[model samples]
Target: MLARVKLEKGCKSRGIKLSGALAAAGLIAAHSTKDLSDHQREKYAVVTLIDCRSILDPVLSSDYMGFYHSAILNTHDVSGGENLWDLAKRCYTAYSNAKNNNKHFTDMGDLNFLMCKAIENPGLTPSSSLRTAFISVFEDPVTDDTNEMHGEVGVEDYVGCSSVHGVGPSVAIFDTIRDGRLDCACVYPSPLHSRDQMQKLIDDMKKILVDGCANGESES
Candidate 1:
């Protein structure tokens, strides 16, 4: 929670959001791994999901409630060692610029067309291989004061629920905050991925966030 708060403040100072910061950190950590060669790193396409409800028209906003987000694919080179703050700024700025230009809505028709073509001709699709995608959802953390049950029930005991399927991407991160703590669940294509490696990746992500927050504080 402390790390999240510090990151939020740091993002606010730079006109970005916490999700963007997380995306930046994750991208850096992902590419920094020694196992991945420069060629492999260059081939990575990091996609950042953005919610578009606020930018839609009032009628469309009220009518649609399902899958209204678009992805901002970052194809820029992240080869060299770069400052987290600068990376975050770039990521946020790209998304911000896209939103400001209404690309989310404007590009919908093209995306639909491409999807139809891909469905008709699977070969036209770039790759069938699945890659891990990172997602972060920072909700208001559950606390005693916010608990509707008051002292009658222990809010800390509550656990969120989710459903996963075998298809789709190889791995995805579902992050949420509860009781002032970050809870991240990595959903992977079971049996295909090593449990130890996935756990280490999660641990590395956490360390990156914590270190980024600490460094931000020291710099401030």
Candidate 2:
């Protein structure tokens, strides 16, 4: 019986190709807006999956994401840190410093210090406006989101793949949002292995944003 089984051998199986899914997902993520002319406007629904319930009052109390409406305020002009990496580094430094010292570093002050230090380097006399812009990048939900799950999103979900590769979630959000979508830079897991996963993230984010807006409206 053993000899017969050996002779039969294992059946050869054709491996399913996931490259196509990955490629399609890449194209979706790479979608551009260069085609839109100056003054061209398109309606985009806002979405955010993180429960920003408390921060909502702080952000909404002001013109949170206010730069979107003004003519002069563009992505590069308003996203305080240089790139995703830079933002991540700043976040890490601030968090570490605060954790070690047991003293809270306010976001705005921490950002301003980061900006000053960034410009203090030789041959990097970037403008105060540029530094200020970096200091004003959008805030993330301070509440823990590692356990909540809605539409394939959990706390671990907000932590994007880049974070696994040593890239913090802040930077991922920075890079992703630079594409012009107001809702692009999110601090959440976005396993972009397939279009379906991407869509799930987007849908989940929209749900959160809608819910937050409703709550805000009701509170008012």
Best by TM-score: 1
For candidate 1, list the clashing residue pairs, or say none. none
Model 2 Cα lDDT, one tens digit per residue, 43-147: 211111122333443454332432321101112111211222222233334333443453332343654465456556423433222222211122231222224
* Residue 3 displacement in candidate 1 (angstroms): 1.9
TM-score for each candidate, following the candidate numbering: 0.71, 0.23
Cα RMSD of all models vs. native, in order, equals 4.6, 20.7
lDDT per residue (tens digit) for residues 1-220 in model 1: 6766776788888887765666666667767755655555443444555556656666355235475567554444565465677877877677678767877677768755754565566555345323323333221221223445644676445444343542233345556565565666666656666898667666776787788778888888
The weakest ten consecutive residues by lDDT in model 2 span 69-78
Candidate number of the best lDDT: 1
